[model samples]
Target: MKTISKWLALVVTVFLVLAGCSGGGDSADSGKGENGKVQISFINGFTGGDGAYMKKITDAFNASQDKYEVVELQEKDHYTKFKSGEYDLVVIHGNNLETYKQDGLIQDMSSVLEKAGIAETDFHQAGIDTVKLDDTMYAVPLDIHPLTMFYNKEFVQEAPKTYEDLVKINDELQAQSKDLYALGVPSSGLVEFYMLMIAAQNGIDLEKDGYLNFAQPEYAEALMQFHDMVWKDKVSPAGLGLDGEFQTFMKEAQEGKAYQTAVALTGPWFYGGAKEKYGDNLGVAPIPQIGSQLAAYGNSHTIALPANVKDEEKLAGIAEYLKFMYTPENLINWADGGQAPVHLPTLEKVTAEQEKYQIAYQNSQQFDDYVSAPQVYQFGEQIRYMNESVFSKVVTTEKLTTDALMKELEKATEMAKQIAATAPQQ
Candidate 1:
């Protein structure tokens, strides 16, 4: 009886030990908020070369402090991981923020910022406005990525002040030689092409009355003119889609086959690539304007906290790291992506490297022509749909009809309205 009891005790003890091991207590908790170490996952959709620039900033931030650590998760997969409640903070583009906010994946940082004593004015007005909805701030913007025309100083020496001037130059270039197209428009660059053109041509305010009103006649006219420039005038490449449009133009520019692109609708990374590939031949200008309004299509990369992160000290630490990221000292490093800084005060005090990126940014006559906020979300898509139809027909040399295109625009706007209705608003 004693031996049997001893064997049963041994079995029970072994079972308990196995259960403890399976419970994962010994394994390190990736998110253990203990011992003054706060782990934050920084998420972004930046899978491009720009990711390298942001990584540089994040790495420095992590090393700068023992209290907080920022681990950047690259691409859409980052969000997938973040959604599993594995992250504390988010640093993503504005496009995905609204949905994230609605899904309760991200927390409202307004109260958090207030408690932390960070003034809203400490950041750029545009940046602040970009992340706020219905008087509640959700994300904090890092930079305003707007469209600028990067031109070749060799062929187009004089900056065209008006759309007429730009069109006239295109006419001259096209009339001279077929191989030397005056401008190239990306086929897949539907959203960017429409927004920049609308901003330059009519100065459409993307945000109005909590919804997008893109069916206005002025917007339609801009779309028609853009279509005319590409298809009717043969200025842009034919049979091109979004993927090939920029590459075709860049290749042509490098080979001296083209003079200038219709406009290079890209973020700051383009400037660095141009400097490396085509040195001194590049010039940047804010998208040109045809009217009194001079708004450009811009988007923001923002910072936010996950809905479940409840630590006050961790939130404070994250804000401090963000303050560091936005400061002039760190912004210069952030500018390695070749984008202009969001903080206007630091715009003038840049390093030599930043100046190289700023040359084109500073020359833009309509640098203030930026429309990078929540309103752009729906209207941007509608404009892209309209532009793609008109531009594609133009590129293929199809007959330009106002009626057919108008129908498409109406459908797109209606679709956008449906989407907006279902869209998460917070």
Candidate 2:
């Protein structure tokens, strides 16, 4: 919520349009403008509220320096545009680095960050590993958005840290009124939530299991913990279709009207809107630990050097921008944008002054078990298989039985294998 008005908030609507819709590049140009100040064009999928945060970051850099100007664009197809050689720097998801590297769309970033005075070790190891392939780095890690629980403060007096707490909170709310329920399983990040349970409760290792490792009974049992919440436990309603949890969480409760969906397990992106709607009533916490660990499933944003940019001037600008952006003071505002700063130095700053960034910037304890995507080129595809092919079907169709889920997993596994075979060798 702090980032809602941290810097340059006014006139953001106009900035939003220009940042998200504009396109840039010159085929014969060396990315250096006539003034001799290099122009570094950046592209990313940080559209909507996200676009404002990133735009502010780049805008600040542009104002602070005269030697370079950073222009950022928010494109739905950012990676594709980067591949077209129109952008020098682009932000991609941690899960996508492998695909980007394999396709030769980005160059090794092992030296770019180091040369900019940012140490690779300062980032979360899991985040660092996401950009590394064959011991070579391809991107500089930005922020981590871990799956967390957002609850209505009025409905639940305290955050649920354990499975028992969840049950008690659920019963207490339902006791007041049947319509008031404390838990609402997510639809968009269903795969991450499911994997978080298995890792915490069952201790399933991702590296050992591989990317498409959802066919086992243990995995099925873990997934059912959520499906049962909707079907058997009755904590959540059936057919909470795509992003229904978030939609309901942000739904403004009328005067004297209690929220139907009071609790949500979603990523940090929910903070900007939820805080606006619920204010201090919006509480955030690590996703409750059903077992021994509070390991949360997380995703990250990484700034990568697009391979198409060969201009030395633009590369210099990109390097300076990386250094300026991650400077602890400059990067702190990013957390106000509802992300956990994975850069260790910036992490220290956020935790040292919790209330300063307390709203949605997750505290340090959450990252102890925070993880990036599995080291597989098909990681993104595996999530698609689970979310669209398997998990979503369970929610929409109410096929909660283990045998039924396993059958769907088998089909998904075949898909996983087919895609792996078709992909070029690493």
Instruction: TM-score each candidate.
Output: 0.80, 0.86
> For residues 132-155, what per-residue lDDT tens digits would candidate 1 score against the true structure?
865778877677776556666666
lDDT (0-100) at residue 207 of candidate 1?
A: 44
Output the TM-score of candidate 1. 0.80
The global C-alpha lDDT for each of the candidates, from Candidate 1 onward, is: 0.61, 0.73
The best candidate by TM-score is: 2
Q: Give the TM-score of candidate 2.
A: 0.86
Q: Given candidate 1, what's the lDDT at residue 113?
A: 70
Best by lDDT: 2
lDDT of 1 at 4: 100
lDDT of 2 by residue, 1-426 (tens): 776675557667779988887655453255567777778878898876767777888889989999998877788877676766567788988878887777777898866777788887888786677677778888888877777788899888888888778778878877877666666665655555565445555666544333456677776777777777777777776666677778767664453453476788776676778888888898887777875555766777888887877776777777899999998888887876767777888888888888768743553457677755666666777657777657776665565688898888777766766665555653
